[model samples]
Target: MRALTAAAIGLAAALALVLAMTAVGAPSGETSPEPLLTTVPKHP
Candidate 1:
């Protein structure tokens, strides 16, 4: 019984976090999905 209650609480918290983020519209000017860097310098 104790384990079940703990699991339910954790699930609720996670759902709340997701909803909050969606409501906030992500962080302002934040890099969406981050950027990938893989460029080589050109030789002169």
Candidate 2:
């Protein structure tokens, strides 16, 4: 039971770290270039 609790806590901590890094590393909308998909021509 203790091991299970520790594993769950570790998983939660890792998830939090990943989320924090993504939030910090992501580019702001104003400075970001347009997505490539938008520039591609659509075939009808």
Candidate 3:
């Protein structure tokens, strides 16, 4: 159906926009911090 196709296209476009924004805002090179998970103490 045309409606379903349109919805899928809109969703894809929104997702791409979000990804682009995230990429643009993200830190690059040496300034990036180590991932938080690595800093957490592991349980025995």
Which candidate number has the best lDDT? 1
lDDT of 3 by residue, 1-44 (tens): 99999999999999999999998896666854755565668789
Ranking by TM-score: 1, 3, 2
Residues 1-44 of candidate 2: C-alpha lDDT, one tens digit per residue: 99999999999999999999988897656754855565668799
- Per-residue error for 25 in candidate 1, Å, reads 0.7
Q: What are the per-model C-alpha RMSD values against the true structure? A: 5.2, 5.2, 5.4
Cα TM-score per model:
0.61, 0.56, 0.57
User: Which pairs of residues collide in candidate 3?
Assistant: none
Tens-digit lDDT string for candidate 1 (1-44): 99999999999999999999899885667566966867876889
lDDT score of model 3?
Answer: 0.88
Worst 10 residues of 3 by lDDT: 31-40
| Total colliding residue pairs, candidate 2 | 0
Q: In what order do the candidates fall by lDDT, top score first?
A: 1, 3, 2
**TM-score of predicted structure 3:** 0.57
Q: In candidate 2, how many Å is residue 26 off?
A: 5.1
Instruction: List the candidate 3 regions with Cα displacement exceeding 4 Å.
Output: 26-44
